[model samples]
Target: MDLLPLAVSSVIFLLVSVFLYSWKLNSSGTKLPPGPRGLPILGYLPFLDRNLHLQFTILARKYGPIYRLWLGSKLCIVVSSPSLIKQVVRDQDTVFANRDPTIAALLGTGGVDIITSPYGPYWSNLRKLFASEMLSHANLDASYVLRRNEVRRAIRNVQEKIGTGVDIGELIFVTELNVVMSLLWGGTFEGEKRDRIGAEFREKVSKFIELLEKPNLSDFFPVLARFDFQGIAKEMKDLLPSFDEILDYVINDRLKIMDSEQVEGELPSAKRGKDFVQILLDLKEQNVAEESMTLTQIKVLLVYSTTIT
Candidate 1:
């Protein structure tokens, strides 16, 4: 009786092990684009180079244009070649237009920004407003004076530092940040204040980008999502206060000017510049606006415009 029971237990263990192994293999075995085998859990994360574009180009040479990479458990399709990119992005535009709603996008956007919004009327309205107002040629022309002045200032500064040993990349980054700040704020700062604000804002923006780019295990492995291995939630909590502080300052400054005009009951023409904040405030006053449109929305829009430019 003892021998029979032992034999039964041994058989059961062998069968269970085989079943689990087969299940795991099958779960990982989907019809995906061919590429290197990812490690168990980490995926092909280790193989990824810091310069993603160049790395993808190199991979395209070996795995073709539309190769798949295992980012954690998620299957990431990489389209490197122009022809393939066009085919996926332009030829099948609608199918590719929607945001994927990954954890990173959700956290970065705070579930409201236009780019990360789902396809619907809300997104349509936001897109139309963005396209017609911010991206319009007229607005660009209006904003050109600010851009020109900032560029001139940057060129002069660069020329002054030509003989000195300086990192060109840092100089360019500062110039770009200054241009964006001028557009958003309707003025530029100088001296200590400029340096301090620039440093803080640059650090915040870099942290934001880093968080967005970091691989979340939850995105790949649904089961591991519960564990939050990437610590994305924690990172977001740390970054949110700084992000909110910057937005609050911009919003408060704009509001102060608007409030002062209202108190004086005067149409202050000289105080007017067609900045994004001004445009959004006007939209808010008009009441023909979507419910999702808020101060937060305006801030996010400004950020997107700056990043894109």
Candidate 2:
């Protein structure tokens, strides 16, 4: 009788699995773009060449301009022709707005920021907020002095190293990072403290970007994402605390200053107007219905701003 019960249970499970699999095929009735067949699970990931541009060109010739490739569980539709690109990006934008973000990106930013969020009301709201607040003319105008000063500093550095063969690329990278940091938070950590913090940030940022670019099995086989079989997610988690430390110090320092400013009626932290960090902080304090951002969202925004690399 026990064996009979076990057999019945097995049959029921088999029936449910078959039903679900059939339903998946039925639901996705639309045909996918034809391309090379790949192995089960790994898909085309193993077959990808390091020289991916050349490989893609070869694939384009074989599969036509617009074709598909299965990267593990993920299906990628590549559009080579400009007309196809326009059709996908402009005409069919709504149909393809959602993105398949890597597990590292999710761990790094908590999947709430604009780039990681799904195509939904939350993403739409974030876009509207970014357009009206972050990319607004007033915000860019306010950041002009920060940009000019950083460029002038770079010029001075280059001038000092004239005929010494200064690496212009390195000079530009540091200058850009400084401008991003200043725009994110101006004069929060001045002089030695600022330089020290920037150096620490650069070290962490290097590892963070490295992990972001590194290929991981989890992103390919999402069923293994929870396992983090490749350790990409764990590395990202480890990097988070370091990022949090710097962010917490700067944010708390700013909060203290803002509190003092409130008491004394001063906004001297800003030269012309509030920078991006200040504006985000202001929004964080407000209780705007359905539009208010959370602390995680705010912190993620701040960290991502410095991810120029």
Candidate 3:
């Protein structure tokens, strides 16, 4: 058994080495932008400095305004000059509209939310939805009380701390989470239930954020993605259930309330202004566009709207 395992490992290593050498030795006929020559297979990945910005700046001085860099098997184009950047971003926006979504980002948003969706008609629709529903002045003005209350609550907590040390990041996260919760759930939860939910949800969000930034080998080398050697995919999969639990609870609760009110002849206007969650729910029900959003998409949108804010 041990011998078989060793032989398999050696074969895998040999295959990878052969592929790398062939990839390195082969030259593309098409000319590419100027850049420093890098190592075989791995390219500049192994030679990367900790200060990426500074390293890229130095490379720009040597290579020119635009250059190509190979990180593992991935090819990256670095644009340094202001004029070139403007051309890429403004003049030729559609040419470079889409982004390569990371594993964590793809999982978290389900590629449905405005942030992760590919640049196309669906993405344009999401952007319009964001502007009209989420970022509208009316929506912001409506959420003012929630934001104010959260800020005041944060200040009071800080005041209580007095001279003791405080973690500004933690305080800010709590305040933001509270405001988001109020906006999403419409004050359905209060005091202990809210605190418990907040604490639990905070852990999940923090882990998800960290995972978003975590460097995974699979990202650099697509061939290794299926193996998930770093367990990044596993961690993200584990968190999804917890996300579903909270989302389902809140959504189901609100749905019940909406049904009750409809049966009782109570209009939506009679209640407090619809929250972000309610608005999204209503949008889906009304089939606001040619493509109706799924429940999962709504949940992802809710998460994106709350967290990105």
Highest-scoring model, lDDT: 3
Q: Residue 235 deviation, candidate 3, in Å? A: 1.3
Per-residue C-alpha lDDT of model 3 across residues 196-218, encoded as one tens digit per residue: 87677768877888898888888
- Give lDDT per model, in order: 0.72, 0.77, 0.79
Q: Please, what's the RMSD in Å of model 2?
A: 5.6
lDDT of 2 by residue, 1-309 (tens): 469999999889878866654454445536866677665445678899999889988999999998878787777878888898898889999888888888889888888977889998998877766667766888778777767777898899888887798887888778988887667765566677877887887788789889989999888777887888778888899999998898788788878878988999976446544566677787677654266787677777776666741
Per-residue lDDT tens digits for candidate 1, residues 1-309, read 469999999889878866664465467667656676665555688888888988888888898877877776566788887887898789987677787776766877776777888777877777877888776787666667667767898889878987788787987877787777666655324467655765677678778777777767677677776678779867867887887787777677777777888899965224344566666676777755666467778777766666665
- Which 10 residues in a row give candidate 3 its minimum summed lDDT? 21-30
Ranking by TM-score: 3, 2, 1
Which candidate leads in TM-score? Answer: 3
Clashing pairs in 3: none
Error of 3 at 249 (Å): 0.8
Model 3, total clashes: 0
Give candidate 3's TM-score: 0.84
Q: What is the lDDT of candidate 1?
A: 0.72
